[model samples]
Target chain A: METKELQEIASLLRFEAVRMVYEGGDGHPGPALSSADIVTALYFDILKIDPANPDWADRDRFILSKGHACPIWYAALNERGYFQPKVEHFHLRQLHSEFQGHPSMKNTRGIDMTTGSLGNGIAIGAGMAIAAKATGKDYYTYVICGDGELQEGLCWEGANMAAGRGLDNLIVFIDKNGYQSYKTVDYTVGRNNPAERFMAFGWDVQEIDGHNFDEIKAAVAAAKQNKGKPSCIVCNCVKGKGVSYMENNNNWHKGVPTKEQFALAARELRGISL
Target chain B: MRAFSGSREAFAAALLDMAEYDERVMVISADSLKAMRAVPFGEQYPNRYVECGIAEQCAVDVAAGMASCGLIPFVGTYCGFLTMRACEQLRTFIGYTHLNAKFVGFNAGLLGGEREGVTHQFYEDIGIVATMPGIQIFTPADPAQCYHAIRMAAEVEGPVYVRAGSGREVSVYGNDAPFATSGITVWKRYGTDALLLSNGFVLDRVLAAAELLSQREIHVTVADINILYGDDASEILREMAAANLVVTVEDHNINGGLGSYISKLACENRPVRVHRIALTSYGESGPANELADAYGFSPEAIAQAVAAARTQQ
Candidate 1:
């Protein structure tokens, strides 16, 4: 797919993800919006997956280490025809729905690991990459983590292990949106460079504009071709991309849009369509 | 059952055998392979083994992740660390996620490094794991049973918690000894005057108790209640109705172990007088046999509890 097509799909995914959250009345829309483009590129262009054969042994595995952004993942999966997009099931925690507050492996299709507790996804992705290498399976493992979740000790544990083991098949993307659940990245953890940090951990690091399809594709390609070391793509993203009212706003971290706000956000996201 | 061996060795060999047959079999350890007797499997399949180095939480989450990618992950760790230390991750990642991960809790019950004191002894592990929904809890009676249980765990889907006892040379079952996940085994039956239900390390002692009771014309029925998760209500109730008394035994605390489950079963179903023989409190540093005696988990202790219960009536 062309760069323009990927961006358009990302916009569509962003619009759908926001709409799902708005309609579902609860979710982490900010992270979902922040990660929309990368998720779009991976699901549409990078990953070697058959939506029909979700359990395909040779298919590339994707783990949403920041699982709270599952609204976006579910939207992408729905768009990819993994299942019929049931917008109603979004944010259905403990309600026996496929779309839970966190990404659950049992409830959803295309969800490789059920992750809500942060810092767990990277370790799991490393395990997957190791398994692939051990079993001689030609498949890559991609893990998308929150910038704030980088504070977790386990991520570094996995990062160290992955680099030490030389799991070149594993690729980690840090959504470097400068905001956390409570405050901005600077206010919360004080100036920390994800790229340099990952580089120090022996990962081949690349800093990219998360929303830019070309940059994401190039970085992903580089990661896939790279050998002997795990790759880290530090993506600079807006907390709430496309929605002016919510963009870069900390309040929208997990707050559901009101009916009026939802309408306005939807109209703005869809442009002339609404 | 033809795979007659010691429990720890049998579990290790069975895991290796499973890994040899299935490339997806992966074992993660918290630097306790020698203690867990998983060194053989680790040596045989180096790529399949992960040494997580004393991090139980990492071991659990990593296993959950490995299991997510179609790998049959057996997390080998001391029962105390696996249960008490990294329990939340186990509940969330393994139990809640329903991953195909088996937690091989080595040195379960008072069978752990008993000389290391209360911290290493995992007397409450079975009770804790059994409470988690969707996790199949297994406690193999002997080495032969452990082999079958480990093999069967691989075939069974979803998360499994196998409480592996330490290398204590208890009486091994015959070569023909059969095992199943949900079924309780009747190890010995002597006219059903009373039913002595037990699991794991307490099985031999319960058998001994039943044998001793038989000489006193008590005619006790000894049951190896290996499956400790569910109530085993129907089986217990039937035995309670048939027998004059119901006595439960375990190398665990009286609060939530096999005895508690059997007591609940007896109370709800048959309404019989139930006698529980188990550890009443945390243990101290000593030999396993001495600790068992101090904590009232010895064969004589179980027998005396049953005799006392019988005499009360």
Candidate 2:
């Protein structure tokens, strides 16, 4: 759980995520790589979970609302001992693979809810939090959603409910990578700040450097400390975090990387700063 | 003929009965507690009631989430909003996962919310909900069937969509009548010349149509298709094959409703000629009975359609 070890895990997750996209022939590598650090921190440093007992009643729930970046989640889960790292782990998006293009609760391990459609995770997580509150369980629910997913109206519907009901046990992280499907989120939508939007919806909002482990840990800790309101941590991130050529490139959002690009991404994630 | 009684009251009574025994039974509404007659349930089990306040999509996804954690959440809302407004959430969150969520679509079909115009009245929900795989669609006739269908929904696991009709209910079966888990329930078997299939409040019209046909010396088999989806179909198919003609009557649109299902079943299994007496177009604002009559779902209209089919045969 040291900073260096967490950094190492994040790098490895990035490498695995890139490699999975490369092997699978089709995936959102940009989003996956962008969320590598946040996912790594949650699995390794933050979330209270048991890989052997994914359905433990007292375990904290994690929902990846931005589900296209599931390769990052799969990588983190594999490294956290949820499942053994196998050659097939790289067979993401292939027919019948446990790692689907999007997170499937039925197919994936350690996934509490199936979320492919945008804006659903917030409500589902709120439901979990409400269940915990109603049942006298104290387990927290953590949801990681993409900034682009904010365009979906259903997200606010859930967000409004969560805040209205005072779901303090819920914590959400918006991966503000700026890019959506084809272009920047601001270019596609307006330059709306997620911090202001969630705050206006009665959430406890905070801005953080998404790739910075210290800020990520501190923000989550701060969110946990706050009471009587659901928390939203806006993590500003690069489209592709660890790779040089794929960084901020929208075309790399889905296309499988060439052999040279894959090798270059792998080398960069293996301790190269650039 | 008995007076028309709304099924929403029966649904509320059944929901309250279930909530009394099962602690997991909770109701989530889009601010439709009064419309759904779930006030008593809310008052008795205040902790179990959730008011989502007009956000149907959030209500459904919230129910899906609650179901994930071992709670049976029933969503109560108007059929128009519940089926279309929150359809994506239903399809992805509840239907895809087959969550233990029950959706009671109050005010279903063209006869539902007659004065509310096309905005509130939905005649296309059955078809839309039928497209979602693994979600059982239940269309109940009379208050007794409504009670039984809701009770079944609470006891059954996975996703269940109960198409609870609006006000203006008719008694098709007695309170003590047994509920069928699959296939159609035969209420009046006059003859095998035609298989008359109908459900929900429209069954009353179909029954009256049968009586009118009997006056014309045309005896027909009258069966209420209480269970819409997940039927074993062997018994229903046998009943269909026995008849030379099959006439399906409903208060819903012809496409993707009971008529379409029966027609497909007959064409595939029995090869019988099928005639559908249903709303082929959208509903407009009017009195419920007047709308029903104009939409070609009245007793006289159904009888005429059946007589015409008989002549063709």
Candidate 3:
């Protein structure tokens, strides 16, 4: 896929994610929008996934470690034909719907692990990578985490274990949107570059603009070429992107846009329709 | 019989046996190999063992991760820390996800480290874990039973919690004992004047009380309940309904342990009177025997509670 086509798909995903949040009356749209391009590039262009065979042993595994931003993930999965998208039942807790508040392996299709509590999905992804190596299967496991989620002690434990074991099949991406639930990353961890820190921890670090499809695809391709050590891609993204009213706003982390604002955001994403 | 041994030793031995047969068997410890007695397995299969170092929460979460990758991870930690300290991780990562992780909680039910006070004592671990959905809870009485239970838990799919007693050795089941996930075992048979139901290290005390009561013409029957969570209450209620009295003893808190479950089962099934003998509250620092006596968890206390209940009738 070309860079322009990927960018168009990402814009559509962002619009759908925001529309789902508005319709469902609850969601974390900021991180979802921030992660829209990366998820879109992976699902559409990069990942070797077959929607018909969700449990294909050699298929690439993607885990949303910061799982609250599941609207964009659901949008990608639905676009990739994993399941039908239900806009009305997106964020309802515990309902017998296609999507859950957090991804559940038991309830949702195409979800590898159920993740909501911070700092657990990466560990599970590491396990998947280790399992693939142990079982002699050729596959890669990709885990995406929030910049704020790095504050958890378990994430470092998992990172150290993955690096120490030389899990080349594993790749970690951090959505460095620079904000957490309560405050900004500067207020939380105080200006530590995630790529440099991961590189210090013995990872092959790649810093890229999260909204740029060409950069994301290139980094992902580079990560696959490198072997013998895990790769960490630090994606620099705005908290909320594309929509002018919600861009870089922390309040949209889990906020639902009003009906009027939702129409305006949809129009901005559509952009005069060719 | 292969001599008397503790549950921790049996668990370690069984884990080694599984590792010898299956390369996918992995054991992760929270720097408690000496405490959980997995040194033998670690010595033999160093590659399959992970020493996660003093963090029970991280230990359990790592085990869950390992399990997700198709390795059967046996997490070894003390009962107090594994259940209480890392409860959220256990509930979300393992229990809710129904992962294939076996959580072996050593020193359960105040059996070991009695002098370590309330910090080390875990009186409600079994009850607390039993409440979680899709968890199989097992409290073995002796070494042989622990061996069978551990092997079964590892081979079986889904999450399991094996609450093991301390180093106090006892001989109850022989090598021929059957160990199933949800089955209960009967220890001694009497004419059924009264029935004594027990689990964990207190099973020996219940047997001693039964022997004493039998000599005194009480004719008590003893049942060693290994599977406490979601036990077949119908069979127990039928047996209790026929008996003149039912007494339950355990080295655990009175609220959520075997005694509480028996009391609730008896009241709901039949209108039979039941007597409970267990620790009423938190324990103090003291020797094992002294704490057992102070907390009313000894054989003498079981006999007294039964005798007092009989007198009141």
Sort by lDDT, best first: what order? 2, 1, 3
Q: What is the i-RMS of every prediction?
A: 1.5, 0.9, 2.3
Q: In candidate 1, what are the lDDT values of residues B74-98, reduced to their tens digit? A: 8877887898887888898888988
RMSD of each: 2.7, 2.4, 2.8
Pairs with steric clashes in candidate 1: none
DockQ of candidate 3 against the true complex = 0.50
Tell me the TM-score of each prediction against the true structure. Answer: 0.92, 0.97, 0.92
Range of the 10 consecutive residues with the lowest summed lDDT in candidate 1 chain B: B229-238
Instruction: Write one digit per residue (lDDT tens) for candidate 3, span A1-274.
Output: 8988888888988888887788778878998988888899889998888998987777888889899988898888878888754343465443566678777777777877778788876666767777677668788888899999988887876777677667788889999999989889889878848887889889889999988988998898899898888999999999888989878888888898887888889789986332
Top lDDT: which candidate number? 2
* Residue A245 alpha-carbon offset, candidate 2, angstroms: 1.4
User: What Cα-based lDDT does every candidate model obtain?
Assistant: 0.81, 0.86, 0.80
Q: Residue by residue across A82-180, what tens digits does model 2's lDDT show? A: 875544456888998888889989888788999888888998898888888877888889999999999999899989999988999999999999999
Candidate order (DockQ): 2, 1, 3
| Model 1 TM-score, all chains together | 0.92
